[model samples]
Target chain A: MSELTLRPGRAFSMVERNLLIYRHTWPVLLAEIFEPMMYLLAFGVGIGVLVGNVPGLADTTVSFPRFVAPALLATAAMNGAMNETTFNMYAKLATEKTYQAILTTPMSSRAVALGEVTWALLRGTIVSTTFLVAVSLIGLTGTWTALLVVPAALLIGATFASLGLVVVTLLRSWQDTQLIQLVMLPMFLFSTTFFPLSVYPKPVQWLVEALPLYHSIELVRACFLGTGWRHALIAIAYLVVLGLAALLVAVRRLDRTLRT
Target chain B: MTTAPLIEARDLTKTYVTSEPYTAVKGIDFEVRPGEAFGVLGANGAGKSSTMRMIACVSPVTSGTLRILGMDAARDGERIRARLGVVPQDDTLDTELTVRENLLIYGRYFGIPWKALRERCDQLLAFSRLEDKGSQAVSTLSGGMRRRLTIARALINQPEILLLDEPTTGLDPQARHLLWERLFQLKEDGVTLLLTTHYMDEAEQLCDRLVVMDAGKIVAEGSPADLIERHSTREVLELRFAAHERQLMIDKCAGVTERVEVLPDRLVLYTGDGESTLAAVHALGVRPAGAFVRRSTLEDVFLTLTGRSLVE
Candidate 1:
């Protein structure tokens, strides 16, 4: 078989293994769900009262909660996917030796990479859906196209999960994971998640636009706020190409690391 | 009623190409017959694990050919792995999952139907003598229990061949013997067993035929009895002497014994009759501190070949 070709059934077995592990570790799932809600309540609702309306997609000015809520949806997906693929994946590769054990079976390294990213997508979907419902209940959702956020959340999840796996392969120790936090915390704050990109200078805006989180927030906000189909498509194509490239790199790295 | 070999390697070698390329397994040839209990006996860093990984089809052969179950290892890895069971050197049990779940989930990896796998899980738990500890977390088990669970998990799919890398390396004597009994049962049930160990007694007891490997090459290959008989004498006399009397004793023993190994604290004399040799030493007025005679074992065979002890 080609190196990249994966048997879906075998890949799903890894998902099944994760499910079995998570069955007893539901508290971790609870924490994943709880973090996004706290972020939504603290930033969207609590701070929205003081911030008033902010600039949204397509030059529209919207309520603070409505503006922040869609960005939180995207952040929720990013967090879910990033947490699973980074810390959890590092443990599997280094400490737990989980993937090494799996590769002993008929499951190819590519299938394992695919399965883990797929599992991360499931987690991202769960978190994004919950956050979407919370914002909708609070009257933040303004368009029927907001439901498109679910699929967009999946794309965001795939993009981060794939890229996060690549970053994790570079990790030599647990301390190196703090570097991930260094990158993520800044991106979470400056990716136009809590504020408008217009607040930044021209050079800063260009730098923000180059980040994945900025595109993720733009795609999610456009879908949730019914901004424009053209804008969403651009973001979608960027994320799709980036996700596939990162996934290819991640699979090849996993093969090299695990097989040898 | 000899059957074809179940696993074969021709000029098998594995060179890890890192910043500094190092060859672990030099060119070596061996074959494991069906239903045979085969072993690769060697010390640490002797390339035993590297060879096992190659035959298990996890590590690709660097410059040679390896075939398992009549399928090429490089091309038919997945298919070959589907029919093979591997118990790695360390316990890779999912510490997060319970013992029973470990078996069930691993069975699922082989695409075994859930119902059938569940039944086999119970049978394997029983076979490993872990019937009561099925629900406990793997982290809670003792080293021997964990090793047994790893073996049971490998058998979840009822594979045709079982590959164990130092299965009882760290276990206590009792646990090691218990594991040996289970492996004996498997051998009787017609499963091909391929194992690697540095323990000479383990190889002697469990391996029907084994190859003594050192520095990535096979130095000796035969049944334990045959190897001992061929490379060693019928008996061995061990004499421990004081530091000052060592050379004097060696010079004294040079006349009676044909072969003698001088260790740091003792001198090992190889002879057809150890008791007569000891008597001869006494007649020479060499009152050694300690003296004993015993039958030659695989340890002697290894020492005869490598000039070093197996464990050291």
Candidate 2:
């Protein structure tokens, strides 16, 4: 393999290429915006009417719509990040051979990995921000601390995006992409994105707590509710470590796969 | 007498360490000088692409030294790559983008300024005869047009050394000729070219100097004319007999030529005077189904060196 060098500038060029493609396919971006909105409408408003307010351990009661809003924000981040790193990355690597073309230039595999993750983070940010605006208009979030969801969603996006890249490198065919939907559906349902962890059995709750999406939901919820700063910091630390570790693995995998 | 070669490889080897370890390129030595059209000629799986990959700085050499433009391939890959234009065996153009957009994005990868890239993109489109299809999607183009666009994309950086791996592998005769003309223009512009191909005609038409590689090693090296002059006879007499009668004919034509290569359906007789050889064979009470005499080509040189045809 050639020397692996990380040039942030070259990574940004990859990001620019994605942006250029997205410019012509703006409808796809619009479609992604609707996924989080529909989730919010179905669970937050439709189901909230029947569930009413949920009790908190600190003698507080949070409305159902507000409770599910932050979890959906984290879900949006995961969906956005995973979609790009899996389908788009796979197409570029296998079908299109775009990564091979890029490698011939000055950009190294490290740059391609970094650039892809960064693009996923940007897409995740877009989805999370739009969801935040829709949720705020529906009177789901009242505190200024909700703004922190942007960075929280970004962290979640980076973590899942890096993991998605690793999965793509291991994948052999389009059929392997089905494995992503399998894992993602479980994470979406069982990670407390639609309901609280208390609804599940203690063993199930423990398993959910170990999930990265569960940590993301915890952090985003704490920010929106303007409470649980201590737990929020823990969630931030967990996501930060996960994102960095996954990024390192992703870069190493891309280097090995693309170079030789 | 001591000027460094533009591209140099000494004892370069590539051993793929997969489940079953395989070595694609054995230790070999070659040099490509500035502004020369150099070629690596070989059949499929002859380590041509592996060698090209190492020189392109995308694949690291398993051992030995490789320098491009006086820079070490392993240490200064980025610097070397910035000045190298590479046309890979397969077309890697972004099918989603327009022909012009493909060139634009490729130029951007080299950090070319937007204004200059736009101008250069136009020049390349014209050079590739793709100006009329500038706004068309790459997927809509024909195989030959796509190939031209790929070559245009590589030249977006105006690279000093252009490495083309089988530039005309799968194209019609007309398209191949047009591509050859364009590549000739690039050579005339004083850009050093290093291309690999199994097509003897392509090598003869485009290359100034070439090496014939068989398996993993360079078997012969010289200009096309020189290689033919040194390794092959002046002309070849091809005689086609029925499948069952080829051996009998070969035995009957003993001592008629310098060498005889028997194929599945024909026999190749290497001799200085093919017409006289054909007449001599006919005088032996053997009449071939078909007979033709032609001057020797690089293919005959490869056959003489490797004991196999170039296409096979």
Candidate 3:
């Protein structure tokens, strides 16, 4: 039972390495922005024209784009974090053997895990912010509180990134990563991202609320709607606890895998 | 007063307990003094890498005491690792990065300051002979160039001890010689080196003293010259017979030398005097198809000690 040790400087070095890589490949950043933009355009704006109003808001009725905008922010964060931690992390660990090189230096495995999750959070925040701006340009923002969605998106990203790192430790091959798509797609479609959980049956609604992304969507939606601070705080606590627990598991797994 | 050894291991062991338990290192003992090149010479799966990993502080010793740079490896891994440089068997260069960026990022991992790390990166690029290719993506570099970059990256920390595991297992002859020359310069600069290799010539060329390992245990340990003198004869007489006459030639050549080894294509006769041994074989009315004589090498020492050839 070796205790995990962290040096913030070492962890920041990992982030800096990724930042250099991102700098060279800035075009890929546009691709991250594109995915959520497509979702917002096709579902939020296009479908909002047909669907008149949504009833889940606390005070007054809102159009479909305003209701769906915050959920897209949560989804953007989840996607960005998952892509970095799962595919990029696995590439470094198994395919490229980059972690082997990093381990030889003074950096600990725990530091590597923390640094990777932080990078994922950064990417998630960037994508979510881009989505927030796109929605504002489309005049979907209702309140000044919508700006708070950025932090909520970061919390969502941290939770998913930590969970993704845990999955990477258990992965045996590139093909196993397809299973992540299976888990994420269902959560993306059914976790109250595109619609309110009230649309589902009672038991199905309970399943939707039980998901990690559900809390993220609930928090971001509250921020955009300017209502439900108490419920939003509960969602924030849920994501914090989930992210911390996943982070602990990820650190332990990285230690076991790399330090062996 | 006597100074402490840079690396000290007493009965260090490593056992892997996956589905079925298997021991990789069977409690080997060795010490590397400061400013000396110490080598662990063995064939693949002989636990050389396992031992090197433990010393690198990346892998923990399963049992027994191990100290590196005067710190316990199990308890002070990070502290030990901070002062050490490691080149693993496989090249772990970041293919996505340029050759120079690889050195820079690796230096940053050791928390080297940015200004100093940039200077070190330039110096290391020159050291590895990749100064012109600093901006080239690592994937575009040849295997030898990639290996050199890895070694250069390891040195970015100005470590006291450098650990190399099979550093030249896959290089061409020219590449191997170039690497050996660079390593010699490192040795001259007073960096203590601990390396593992299955190449007998590499061990003979680089090591001041080495241990020959087989099946997870050291069979012999000494300087290359001393091991050859103690374990092997002065020279060897190689006699190749035609097909189907190999075993017959072994029987005929049995009493003419100290020992005879029957390889696939030839029979190696170990003796104090190779010419005399050849003369004795001819005097016995057995004319070999071809014959040659050479001085004993670390290969011969390994063969004499293990009763098996070093390369398999």
Candidate 4:
């Protein structure tokens, strides 16, 4: 056929394909949801009763559920994004040689990377939406503004997921899966996900504020409390820049890795 | 453009360097015309896969020219890949998706829209005899079914060029036959094919023209029949002796053939006339367990050029 061309959306098609895998592999997806719910119960409700509400929070204008709920939304998005992109991406790229199969056709490594990030976003959106709905039903949501968290969660997921792609490509074996646990867990814990940056020492506050998850928490908190245009704008800008930068690095790295 | 060659490589070489440089594809040249089944026969580490990778455009050449369907591989690699189908030595099908989804998803990689992919997947599933396995995950399919799905996936773009790297390397005989049947059908539809293989019978059965490679260089090039006729005798005799009585039979028929090659297990006598060679051996009181005259084949030509079988 004349004028035939293959588009990079090939990776997007796999988003649908991946959803099918998720459809059958629900236990895996459910497990990711349970982690955040457990934190919400154990820390937000159980521990909040004993410790009282976390004060001087990033969005201190809200109650305890509203405060911790946004943090949980950001954390769950990060968790889902990292879980989907890191080990799954590694397993498929390494042992399964999934992208190799796609590259054999008209697909480029950029398409594969793009598709993977898209799927991660889709997955994170699902987890974020489900968690947002659960928190709203439990009367934690202050406004319909909680709905805006979907796109914000997508942005958060996109940044972490594609960054996960960069890491996955550079890692040579399963031994390197350790890096995600060591690196990401600490980032999640210390990046002001549980409390606002002001709770940390001034220097540590600056460090936490610089983290991608911190920006995600900022965005989610602003969206959850139904307030602050400037705050939400800054958070979105941070993640958008981080996402695009990580995507560019990943596309370039993947192009070298698979095409060369 | 009058039916440009599906694949062309000139002085193509690929070298992987880390601590020390190791060359894989060593300055080889060849062309495969549209719809032609071209075979690359080579011993292990002889650069066949590296050459295939360059033409597939998934790999870049360190030096030399390579083109697929008139497009430069170094530039417009994605454009070139759009018209190219690659069946790598290993089956690279995604295990997570179904057989049908595999085709649909890959077709999209070539930028085929969803509506068209849905239609194309059906036709390819029929062609590869994978229609029944469409929804089943590829991980559950048999080896043959998985291979058929791979072939189907490659055709999703209806590529003008198809590259098969050792297409039948690890298949059972029945599976090999099924794969060959599917390939033959594609050839009938005018898809140009380039294949790398070490199997003599596979090359003989599928290749219209062939190149024998040794140490990453072309040693001989021609049709299977032409190569066999040019490099080997019309017939050969196999001789074996029990225990260690070879000294009595060593000189008996030494002068009867153009050449004699001895192996630890047996002896081969290459001759133009097997009957006369047999008579000469009888006259010298030498007898063999089996005396048969068979048509020459590509294996003999390959052995003559590479000094042994491609696998060894």
Alpha-carbon runs more than 4 Å astray in model 2: A1-7, A56-59
Quality of candidate 2's docking, in CAPRI categories? medium
**lDDT of residue B109 for candidate 1:** 77
Every candidate's lDDT: 0.88, 0.88, 0.88, 0.81
> What proportion of the real contacts between chains A and B does each prediction keep?
0.63, 0.57, 0.71, 0.78
Per-residue lDDT of model 4, residues A1-260, tens digit only: 55365544466766776876776787887777778888998878876776566677544455565667788889889878877778988888888888777777666777778877888887787788888888888888878887898988888898888788788779888998997799878887887666666778888888887888888888988888887669789989888888888889988988887765
Candidate 3: regions farther than 4 A off: A1-7, A56-60
Write down the TM-score for model 3. 0.97
Candidate closest to the true structure, highest DockQ? 4
Against the true two-chain complex, what DockQ does each candidate achieve?
A: 0.53, 0.50, 0.54, 0.59
Model 2 lDDT tens row, B1-312: 266799999999998989999999999899999889999999999999999999889998899899899999989988889899999998899876788888988877777767888999889999999989998888899999999999999998888999999999989999999999999999999999999999999999999999999999999999999999999999999998876777787799887886988876678999999999889999998879899999999989998999899885
TM-scores of the candidates, chain A only: 0.94, 0.94, 0.94, 0.93
Q: What digit string (tens of lDDT, one per residue) describes model 3 on residues A166-192?
A: 999999999999999999899998888
Model 4 gets an lDDT of 0.81
Ten residues in sequence with the least summed lDDT for candidate 1 chain A: A1-10
Worst 10 residues of 1 chain B by lDDT: B249-258
Q: Write the per-residue lDDT of candidate 4 for residues B262-303, one digit (tens) a residue.
A: 666666788887778778888889867656666667766776
lDDT of 2 by residue, A1-260 (tens): 12224345878888878887888897887778888788778988899899888753452488888888898889888888988999989999999999999999988888889889999988888888888887888788889999999998998899899888888889999999998898889889888876777778889888998999999999999999998889899899998888888888888988888888
Q: What are the TM values for chain B, all candidates?
A: 0.98, 0.98, 0.98, 0.94
Query: What lDDT score goes with residue A34 in model 1?
Result: 74
